[model samples]
Target: MSGLGQSGVTAVKWSAVSTLARFVLQLVAQIILARTLGPEIFGIFAIGMVVLTFATFFSGFGFSWSLLQRPTLCDEDVRFAWTWQLVVGLITMLGVYLLAPALSAYFREPRAQSVIEWLSIACLLSAAAAPSTYLLQRDLNFRAGGLIQVGSYMAGYVTVGVPMAILGWGATSLVAAWLVQAAVALVASYVVKPHAVRPLFWYADAASAVGTGRAVFLTNIVNWMLNNLDRVMIGRLLNAQALGLYNVAYNLAAMPNNLLLGALQPAFLAAGARLQGELDRLGRAYFQMLATIFVLVFPVFVFLALESNDLVHLLYGSKWSDAGSVLCILFLIMPAYVIWGLSTPVLWNTGRKYYESVLQLPILAIGALGFYFFAHQGLQAAATVAALVLVLRAVVVGTTAFRALKLSWIELLPDVGRGMILSALCAISVKAGQAAVSDYEMPLLSLAASTLTALGVLTLLLVIRPQILGVQSATMVIRFFPGMAQLLSRANPSTQRGPITNPVSEQRL
Candidate 1:
């Protein structure tokens, strides 16, 4: 047992499996829903999601997360958090129900009234499940948590949502799936870790949680604005159809980032918290994670950006052609968005929660103000503004996190530079591969060729000099594969290296 009763590798493995499974479910669901429903329907649901996601920010007032952050916790704190969040959940549900009409009008989507009202059910369900789920996370029990999560999603989307869409349930299919997923999660999370479900009376028992919860809650609210302001503005300023297109593009761009971060964040937090006093170890682990993620995922987004039009056409059919440009713009910023997300756990576990929260305020302001100005121009302009916000946010939060951690970005540059160089190389490979297959006049085959070409080039480069991606990060990954470490060692020439190129020190992890 490393920290929180599980090794980071094991926790990451389980979480990745769960995240990948859920992504497959979601991707399938999205394909079905997008094909069956009109853009207007998605536009309405997107607006509703905007409201639901906002309420979610303050639903438990971040108390569940406080469970993870607090230096000490008691059963009383768990009970209090559960009791508090349930109450807020009910209140939030009712509030959204009542405000649905007004919110729909503000967004200029009249049908969103019913959509928002129906989706409100998830608010209570999510809140009810928060504490139990957090407890699982705080313990780093990703195995049980992963199973419960993926199983719930499978039940909700596969059993309920997909079949209903096939039956032509329109936007209601989405709302039904949303509620079912939340309800399933609520029941399963509690069952897996049945904490004190007793109601609370004495608020004073939660003094320790309250302090951290307050900061996280406030930060999440600002963070929510940073994430959702573009959607809000796009819906309000543009027509529902336009909003629909942008929503599709935005979610598609965000999917991999969410999946990647969702899998690793818990492990990072638990591991970093345990290693907090060991700054050198913590710094090395953090850099390794960053480099590993960048090398693996950054090129993926680049490939998506380059192939956006064909990807949209293939996945969403020709009707969503307009979304391709939007996807291209949004995908370009994924690296920055992911970098920003990865910084969150580092900041929180290091007890710099307030500093991180403060970082979001101006970013939110800039995004909001920028969107207001640019949204009128078109969806393209709004996406550009959104992209700028992500890059700026990564710079801002990343700098602060580095300062707080007393780490030097200069040390990580060699690895990042190599990843960037590889990305450019893969970009050229994509063009060459696409050209090679274009003669066949098959879009699907062309895409496959491009993807294979890029990945193949990347794999060969890393094999030749895995240290260029940081031996630490590279080693962390291939440790999972038996004998693969020895294979890489044999492929690369032995060198007396300075940190970035040292195969010898890679054994430390």
Candidate 2:
């Protein structure tokens, strides 16, 4: 590997570990919050997040992009970015507070108004946290950033969610959990990057930062709309009960894709940042990434697609059986979504944010119209529309990457072909297991047996075709485990994490 690739890999290793830990914590938190508060409360928290999401999205004003894209940004630039985030943070909080009643009125849920206003505090805290967090990303200090994430997530889960659950707050417990995590992140930022927190009144850098960040911000907005527009539409057209079930199914369907994509996107961006001027190298890197991500994604979707009913019953309980069909259909699109995840960072890092943003408009329009026409048909209709929309979105962006990288459809098809073959194998194996155990009457045991059978089949396939596992070996991920440290150290001298020094800024994380 080149020095840039090596460093990028190490950063990714740390970031992935951190992200995995956070995902685990979040999963546990959501699981606990789900059972304790149930769908009604969980949905409330989801709506609040959606509302606050818009507020915080604008609050960044593209400051992080300025840091990530600018190779020569200085300490003064860092201070300026930090100041901009702080001011925006305060403004976001005020705006959220003022707009809370309007949001409640629109949703026609009076109880949500207070929840929205109280949760607005998190937007301010998040705003304060953004620039410090960006500095960590810019300086490749993912270990620190990861630690903050782990700490904040754990704090929210334990201190807020658990206690509130005990206190019988139900759905309100989610807001409480969010508030605690935001607070923890706010505090940790100051501790991790103290030097970047220099005081400044509103300065002359806003125009410069916003000008650079506008493209990124616009892209993010489009992505947000594409992602949540369906849910927003569902809530408006259908009742909360239907929306709640859809949310559950949608969450489960998206989980595997989100987990892999979450790890891949940041790493992709970091890798792209290092290889900024070399589109050829960037294209190759992304292709390899697409292969790796889909390798894991394929079996996951297949397993979930075949056993959506059993899995939902096992995890979220039998109350969510209505979501099974939704899960199955959404599962069909998981592989395409995973490929999109890998392709997108290349677009972002290659300064194709405007193009990416434009692509999303058509995808969003298709999704919105599809949902409108089909959503009332049934959960199946919504899921089918969603699956088709994903394929369309992936093709639009994938073709864009192909042309921009001077590649052909042939180059992309091989990886996708392999992914399809793997997914088919996995689905057939899982379905065969389901059929074999169909006579069983115990829900828990049937789920356990089906899951075990599917896993065994997947493991056997990895043994038979090692390349199908994505990594070189089944144990490759074990390198991050403390138990394998000695082995990893002996095999690769350069595998050890090293300190990075930023020449342009003295900010520490």
Candidate 3:
């Protein structure tokens, strides 16, 4: 395999394993916290975390992306990035401390101020780790990255989140968990791979990376605001209890997209950076990767949309009935986001960071404004607006991506066209079937039924119109699934090709 290909495979494997482990721990921790502290405390923590997450972009100073995208970063570049990250981290930490009171006042909760102040320390800790993590990613060192993530998550869960839940520390536990995770990461980075580069006091090389970094930072800030403003608004505008329910629902709805896209993103960016000048090759790779994302993600969203009510009721309880609408609407964002995310690495890695930022700003603005306009009404309104914004963002991003690849919408659409159609048809069928089945009233049953129906429909489509999935022939399937060769060979003769011939021989056959 090529370096990119091997890196992708390793990244995917480790990312999947890490994500599964992290999700399990997080889910268990959330469950314990929810049962112990209930909604009000949960709301406070969720809202505070949302704010901190937004501020985190400022702390990184865009160095992570600069480090990743640059073809030949030297020790001086690394040192410059690291030093600035420390400076930015300290400054942002102070800013957070000063801003906490105003934020608390905005949320009408005095307790939140302390939470914000405590969580601010995490900025410095995260800054300490960013260089190490960035180095791992730049080198395509998935093993190291995976180890760091898993260790940090485990530390957070065992030492802070879980213990705090047991002790009934409420929002304090959440803040503590944030601190623990960062602390673990910092310690791991220092001990695991100590850097020998001396820190640069001057900003010459740092200044060079700053422009691209700032654009990325700004884009990240806007993206964070657009994504999390609703939660922030909800915590302040609505009661903490309401915020808790809404937050949980939104998390559930967006989880699949977040996890899947999170895994794909770094590798995609790294791969795209390498393929910058190869437009035809880049476009083909982009489309195929996108198809792969859809194949994995579309069904999950469809299933969630179909079983939102059951899921909300089952996971969160009937007290959160208001969350059902939000879950359904937010599910719409997932598939669209998968498409949009695939284009971003292409845009940003090609040195079009500013262009990407320009494209992103309007979409985020629309989403943010849309959320603010209707969020006062309730979860349903907020979610609907969010969903619409996501769809619009996808359109904007897709158009931009096509233009960059020197192709039109029609050209790009054909490659992904069938997958989308199959997904839609499968979703519709699942929705209809779910409506008919009383099993959907129970969360587990409903989730299972919807999942099964969607999968079955997808399987039927894959079998009947296999060409739609780019697996038209048995040979293609075998090529994609080398491990399945033995099983596939058992198929009846009429359904199978006589033999896999060389391309030259096959042409003459």
Candidate 4:
């Protein structure tokens, strides 16, 4: 309806396309690597990545969001941000390199030292690209950004990761892919926003950027700690094999969140930032995003939880069967994860990041203690604890977000909750169908049949009670596409006579 709305929609579309492509490619690579290198090797790589993720967060210094959220930016601001990023990146690289031996000793995995060292290069490459990429997002130019991300991931995984895995590189393949992906992203960012590379900095600009980014930086630190605490404890308390199993399960369960909702986060933040002062519009947009994300992601997690055994068998084969149980446990947290994902952008864009960080401290402490205590029992126990903690965290964050937006759960929860109910029903029907077809000879065929039965049940339910999934609101979503409204009207003549309205606006009023 407006330029900002149109740009946001276009950005989300491209982001979805990019995320889907990358998800497929990464999934294929993951299967090949899992089959060839096995879980122990992946465990080692996962440890390195855990360390690298912390390093990458430090290197970023939250400056990207600082730049994006700034009402205005000058050349000096861009240069200062880039300079600081590079400084942080180099420091992080050296820090990881020097700490490698001690980290390896702590993890009790000797190979992790090498993996950590190799992956440090990605931090530097990311820093080099930060300014240009921030500018891209600040301008809402997600098409170019999405293309760059997809192309980099595809080229890296296909050309490097798969071949390295075939050549018995094991964890090295993942590190190689990381380096290639980061390098490509850096190059592409510079290519897209050449002016962002200019090197002129001022002290005042640097100080201003840091001041603006302090809250976000602290929030990210807390988030990283909260997210990785379970993994860290698992790697320490359990063997590489266990950690590997848990890692695979976690990733599998998180796949939908990473690929679908993750794709929309930047767009949400950018759009929210633009509408920050407009409470009514921002509230409506936030609810719509939450509802849409819930409807799309709820069934995915439910299905994954229901058929984790079959899905794991189909994807990673019988060797990873243990991961299936872990996957189910992790899936229990997906609804909370989805809510947190949707709400964080609103908090950050509305300058409530500091408050969120403060609120999260107690939750993080409790969760970390929970993980530490349960990790000794086994991976499944740890996962259960983590899931419970995540649900708590979600409740805290969701409540705070609602209060900040001056909105009530009554306005937001009905649509999203209905979708969850529908998803639960689908899961139940699928479980029943699986039992009915228990004698199916082939696992893959059984899985296919079960999935189809779930979809069929969901379709029937939607047709019978379209409001269960908020069909009116879902139909309005189609308006994001050009001429889609008219096309739908042509197909169903009753649609042509009524004007389209924003569902969240109606509900909010």
Candidate 5:
């Protein structure tokens, strides 16, 4: 393989490892914190986090992505990005601190004031790390990046968060955990790959970077709004407790996408940028990525939708049972969310960054209207409206992204369609299994039985027709033991009599 191809594969592997590790740690931490702190405290933290997350969109002024997407960079580019990040970080910190009172009053949660102020420290820490982190990405050194992330999460959640929660710190533990994570990441960025930190600035470099980032900045802003608007409206229209329940459901629903697709994003963006001149190759890679993502992530969402009640009860306890229906509603939108996420890198690489921001306008408007009208009804109703809006948004964005790549729905049907069909079948089987065991009183036993049945059915289907899941038997063997495939091919008498042939190799060639 070429250097870029090797680097891309390495990045993906490390990213996957990092994502899985972080997911496991966060899952444990959330379960512990939910049990200890309860929804009211989580609600308080959620309200504060909404403000903090919004300010984060501007903390780097989108320079991190600009640096990543840039074809080349010099010391001046690094310095310029660092300078802007620091400047914006300070500004955002102060802005959030000052706005804390207004945010607290808006959420009707007075505790938000202190939480926002404390969490603002994280913005500065993240800014400090941005330049180095981007440099690591630019160099395609995801191993270091992944290690930093996993270590930071461990330091934040396991070391700090769990202990603090045990000490009865309530919502403050969450904020403290975030600050520690940021600090660890900031320290690790320099330690892993030191970069010069100075006050140097060049207007031309800064302008170029800013110009490249302008659309990305707007897109991030709009995305942040689209994501958090419902939470904000819920916090305001309902109460912190309701927002807390909604936040848990939303997070659980979003976890698979965040874990799988999020891991793939950096690699995709970097690879897409490198292959920008080769449209055909880039388009093929993009489609393959979408297919791979669907195969990996779609089933998890389907399973979550089918067993939301059991999962909520088993993992989060009866206190959070109210989030079950909300989780089900959120799961309905995840496939669309995953598709939209997969297409984003394609759009970004093609210099269509503004398209996403523009497309989100209608979705945001519709979401806001829905939240306004339905939020008071309850969490499930609000989630239903949000899911409906998401489906519409997905259709529009997916069509636009496909057109930009000059790809047709038919081209993607084999990959994406198969996964959707299989996932649907898996869901139906699990549902049927659950009904067959309706007499079971234990949620845990029922959950295990349904999960096992789903897995068994899925495994049987794959064994019967591997291609339905986009995997052939030979391909699966080759993936694990590449040399064995070559050995087997050479040992075949027909191969010696004629030409050795591998359909998969021919297709790639």
Candidate 6:
């Protein structure tokens, strides 16, 4: 009802729509690419992309966060940020190009050299578009951002990548597709919200911008390591095929976080920044975000974990069966990763920016030891270690974030304490359905039965006992569909534990 609430609703809608569209497009494209190119090719491209992705942070150096957190920005700051991005992109691109051979060699795929080299171009393209893309986020305008992402994916991956894979171009197809995606995004972003690209020639031109981004850059660097170290280890310690399988599994297990939480991130971050000084409002918003993830994302993750092998074969074909075991292991980290991700904006916006980077120091050391120990065993073992590290980091970081905001898990669990119970029930329903047809070779039928059974059980519970997810979550859900608010309330008073109330009601959003 308030201005912040209204814009946030629109932003949330657009962000969710865009991410859902992109997620669907990616799912279809990956399925096709997996069948057409197979694991070996994807593994090779993964090696290159992993490197480029890590270096990508430097290309913009978290300047986007720098933009968002700032209350005021002069033209010089924007131009400098753009110029800095372009220069760093070029440098990182060149570095990746030169190291392509070594990178490919490390992955035991000498043929990946050219692929990595070509993929380096994406760095430049994305860097060039940072100012424009981030400017939209800064303004809380996610419509153009969503449109750019979907249109780019369609133009690049769905339209280009799939065809090339079908034609047997291998990694070249992937490289080309990614470049095209970046190109399309670059062009579209600038066209929608143009920013000056002229070089400022001196860092002093935007000292405040540089100062703000320092910790964010460091934090992103460590976050990238936490996210990708397993893939790096898999590639180095195992082989291309193993890396390929793990990548696919990782993608599947992390999809919920990638799609839903990721989509909500920009909107939530911008909204939090607007109320950076309002501790109560920000903490309430944070709780709502966790609730949203628990209610919407946990079910999907549970289904994935419970039905990993069948789900893999159903979607990515039988060739990807090995990734199922790895996916099952990786599922342990999904909810934890969300906590880690959501905490970043809280830290950065609330002037606890450097605290995150510092926290990563011990966690990174622990993670490195775990990965080094388990990586040599096998993919599943490595995945197990990755999951442990993520959970640990989430606990540490999430606790720290809570304390920083003057909130605590014990205080907040009432809103989502029963989520684990709901997830457990859903998992049981899924397993029961699978067990009924365990002997049959009908993945589709089994999946359908499992899904329907789970949905039926969840719906029944929510209808009879809406308090299962607490009033806060129910209120948040209803806020997304205001018309249902009164209907649900009037339908049955006993259904909910407490009266539904907006967490952001008349607050600073």
Cα displacement (Å) at residue 422, model 1: 0.6
Candidate lDDT scores, in order, read: 0.80, 0.71, 0.71, 0.78, 0.79, 0.80
**lDDT string, candidate 5, 1-509, tens digits:** 11125456567778878888888888888988898888889999998889888888789778766778888877777777788789899999999998899889988999889999899888888888988898887777888898899899899989999899999998889999999999999999989877667766675667767876688778888888878888988999999899999998899888877886757778777777887776666676566566655665677788878899998998999999999999998986798887777688878878787899998898888888888999899998889887887777778877887888798978666667777887888888888778878897677877888888999988777665554645322232333346545533433345544333344233321
Question: Which runs in model 4 stand beyond 4 Å of their true positions?
Answer: 1-4, 196-198, 480-496, 503-509
Flag the better candidate by lDDT, 3 or 5.
Answer: 5
lDDT of 1 by residue, 1-509 (tens): 11222366677888888888888878877877888886777888899899999988767788788777765788888888888888888999899999999999999888889999998888888999999888888777889898888888888888998899889887888899889888989899988889998998456756767787788888888888888998899999897898899998888888888888888888778666766676566665666777766666777788889888878888898899899999999998998988888788778877788877787788888888899889999988999999999999998888877877787788778777777877788789889889997777666887899988888888788777765655645555555553566545533345333211333223322
lDDT tens digits by residue: candidate 2, 1-509 = 12135456567777877888887777676666666666666666667777887777777767766877676777777777777777877888899899998887776666777888988888778877777777777777778888898899899887778788878987677787889898899789778876566765446665666677788678778878877777776666665667777787787777667776765676667657767688766766665555545555566777778777777777777667787788888887887887777778777667677888888797888788888888878768877887887788788898788777787877555556666777777777666667776787555676667677778876777555544443212123332344543433332334446222122112111
Off by over 4 Å in 5: 1-4, 471-509
Report the Cα lDDT for residue 174, model 2.
Answer: 75
TM-score (all chains, Cα) for each model: 0.93, 0.87, 0.88, 0.93, 0.92, 0.95
TM-score of 3: 0.88
User: In model 3, how large is the Cα lDDT of residue 423?
Assistant: 64
Candidate with top lDDT is 6
Instruction: Identify the candidate with maximal TM-score.
Output: 6
Worst 10 residues of 6 by lDDT: 490-499
Clashes of 1: 0
RMSD of 6: 2.3
Off by over 4 Å in 3: 1-4, 294-296, 414-417, 428-441, 460-465, 471-481, 484-509
- Model 6 TM-score, all chains together: 0.95
Per-residue lDDT over 363-401 for candidate 4, one digit per residue giving the tens place of the 0 to 100 score: 888988888878899988989988987887788888888
* Candidate 2 Cα errors over 4 Å, as ranges: 1-4, 199-207, 465-509
Higher lDDT: candidate 4 or 5? Answer: 5
Q: Candidate 4 has which clashing residue pairs, if any? A: none
